[model samples]
Target: MDNNCLFCRIVAGEIPATVVHETDTTLAFRDIDPKAPVHVLVIPKEHHADVVTLAQNDPAGSADLLAACAVVAETEGLLMEGFRLLFNTGAYAGQEVFHVHAHVLGGEPLGPMLAPR
Candidate 1:
């Protein structure tokens, strides 16, 4: 775990978050800043700086992260209307929070907007 990461703190119970889905491997919580009617951040319990870092640390976990998107969709009731999953890899990619997270966003038409720039 990264000693100074915000998500690590949240996972370790040092900080509070509105959690929706949680298991031994991951945790899904409401994003503090929501871009949609239903915006959730699906994060790994284990700490890694970003998706690149996560891939290097545990490639299997990286794949698991993607697979976890299904759970997020089912839980959030976005399976029918469709949902978008996004990962902001680096600073230039708009990854403000260094911790690796998947944005499971949906609940509206959202149009043709890209997930993240």
Candidate 2:
């Protein structure tokens, strides 16, 4: 775990978070800033700078992260209605936190994945 990473701190119990689901390799928590009615962040316990890093270095953990997202969606009652999973890789993509995580969003129409250019 990266000592300076916020998500790592949350996973290590150093920081407080509203955790919704947890497993041996993953954690699902409510977003502090909710973008949707059912917005949650799913992350791997191990540190990875971004999705690409996680996918290349720890594929199993990456899979666990995705699995956790699905579980979070189901638990948050957004499964059947569907949900969007998003990973922001860098500043241009709006990734404030360096630690890799997926945002599970639903509970209402999400409109579009991107705005008009």
TM-score of each: 0.90, 0.96
**How high is the CA lDDT of each candidate model?**
0.89, 0.91
Q: Report the error of model 1 at residue 30, Å.
A: 0.5
State which candidate has the highest TM-score: 2
Determine the C-alpha RMSD for candidate 2 after optimal superposition of all C-alphas. 0.8
Per-residue lDDT over 1-117 for candidate 2, one digit per residue giving the tens place of the 0 to 100 score: 889899999999999999999999988889999999988999989889999999999988888888888888888899788889999999999999999999999999999998899
Cα lDDT over the full model 1: 0.89
Q: Model 2, poorest ten-residue lDDT window?
A: 66-75
Mind giving the per-residue lDDT tens digits that candidate 1 earns over 19-115? 9988778889999989998899988889888988989989988878877778888988999999888899888889998989999999998777656
RMSD of each: 2.3, 0.8
